[model samples]
Target: MSSKLANPSSDRGRVGMRGLRASGAAAALSVGLLVMTGCGSSDSAASSSSSASSSAGGEHSEDLKLPAGWKHAVGTTDFQGIHAETKLPTTVTDATGASVTVTDDSKIISAGDGISSTLEALGLKDKIYAASKDSTSPAGKDAPEHFEYTKQTGTEGLLALDGTLFIGDNTKRHGSVAQQFRDAGTPAVVVDDQATQSEKLQAVADYVGAHDAGVKLVDSVEKDMAKAKDTVKDHGLQGHSVIQITATGAGGANSVAGTGTPGTEMIESLGMTSVGAESGLRGLSREFSNEGILASDPDVIVMAESDYQKWGGEDGVWEAFPTLKETKAGKAGKIIVMPDAQIRYSSPEIGAGAQALARAISEN
Candidate 1:
């Protein structure tokens, strides 16, 4: 497999309702007013509300409301909302062409940090019976100990989990394992690895049968993303050249974020120009040499925190590529190292990622 296939950073990978009586209606009205005050809409609030209402149905439809002044930073329409009334025992065909039946109470095992992050964003972290060891989210930090599986754990470890449903990417390494799960009477939903931020949110919502929650989650993230972008623009940080690199071995081929990669997209979303895109690099990631880095001479260098640590941290990066010491970024001491999971996956944490990048750019 190509390096891009082995490490496609573009894909990352989502709630509840209840009954009420006439007296409950009065209480709900009071609470709704409070929510409106706390999360009022902006000028675009009418359009967002219309779009959200048109896409939702069922008991939670009435409860689904976008915060005022909401707008998507990446796309025009929010594709994350699932049908509010969608019940369990429904069959969904995943990107792998496998039709899996899911129920309201299904115990799910999540693989990949991308998918796990989505589950956490959708307030369904409790539903995960087992999660990859690398899973990290704002909802909790004990997912690894709770389920007991890591990226190094093979198919056997995953199969050992007491789960009724599984959600993950359909990579060569896991395709057969997913099939085995299905054969063993466990339905596995294989999400597309290249899915966009909105698509990732929708996939998780579809599996959990909570479209309304998915919409809300997307809206919340998009709002944060917009704020991050505005912060970059207001700080006069737009158009700064950036390159995101992943360290290999000494003199080995290094992978850099190119066009269509999550890293590039995130940087561009913050109003900065990705040097990889400017250099005509395509695909998810491209192999580059030291000479290429010298030629591009980016103003900023972004990398995964693990890679930064692997190379002995900030000083080590300069040691790995002495030529980098002469670049504008090197002179300014601007090497932004972020968590691999956050930059590599497209999940709700994307907003946080954008904010971090924006902060880095502003400071630099």
Candidate 2:
């Protein structure tokens, strides 16, 4: 697989729901609110200030105020739009230098991953510019108005970026955006929405200024996975299998199943078995299947939470597949409803998604 296949889509999804344009969101993460405030819509026309320093020569590291338990890692990278130098941790050491452990690999990017959350964590939320290109979630169709604001502002050049995070399938429409960043000297971390296990999470770390961020994310995932494994044992879900079907393209109501989809990944991550990697159901009515109205014969069924509600939740899925209620997963009450926000393309959120899946599988 291409490296791009393992990366998240544009950083837009990281803040797509809460607001923040494409490049702007990333720029927000890269540059910070100090430069982005009031610059999203009607340009503020303020003269450039030099508050941000480059990661070169460790200048960025000097300004950071990390969490009480956090410390600088071996390496550093520019974070947010501020180009503030940030470092990741070298070891999972706590204050006592004992290694911290993480279990699951369900990836998640909270508001804390990009500009919006970083600023808030650091007490700079009020300085956010809130401008962004159009963004649309599975729950909310139609991309928002500020979809490509980062590209519009030439953020790629200003921050001197090296990588980006993408959430969905690679399309020319959005691929061009990645290309734009690449052309401007930045690599991208792309992930498909159908990706259930979020194995591609490391791509986000590739862009994080600190190697410690990668370590932290990975450790967190490991801890979550371990917890999931325990949950599976507690629930006796061993040797179970599952599948995920998805519809791609505009209104092309057809269905197909694949190993790449999120639901399948979720099953495998929990140590459950699955059908052939290439095996899947395809070609259903995009109108409904896209919302998960279609059914598959798996031990468990999982769908985006928003789509679950759209499909009428458990009642709707049961009505659509009477057999589902009879299946091991279903009878055992294993239907999973994922948070729509977790479905988007953010690095930090990948861990959160993994945790959710672990919880779903272990609990069910």
The lDDT per prediction is 0.54, 0.33
Note the clash tally of each candidate: 9, 77
- Model 2: per-residue lDDT, tens digit, 24-140? 211100011111111111112222223333221112112222212111111111323232223332223221222322221122111112322322222222333221322223111
Error of 1 at 255 (Å): 3.7
Question: What C-alpha RMSD separates each model from the true structure?
Answer: 17.4, 18.8
Q: Model 2, which residues run further than 4 Å from truth?
A: 1-145, 148-177, 180-199, 244-257, 274-296, 312-333, 341-364
TM-scores for all predictions: 0.64, 0.45
Q: In terms of TM-score, which candidate is strongest?
A: 1
Question: Model 2: how far is 243 from its true place, Å?
Answer: 3.9
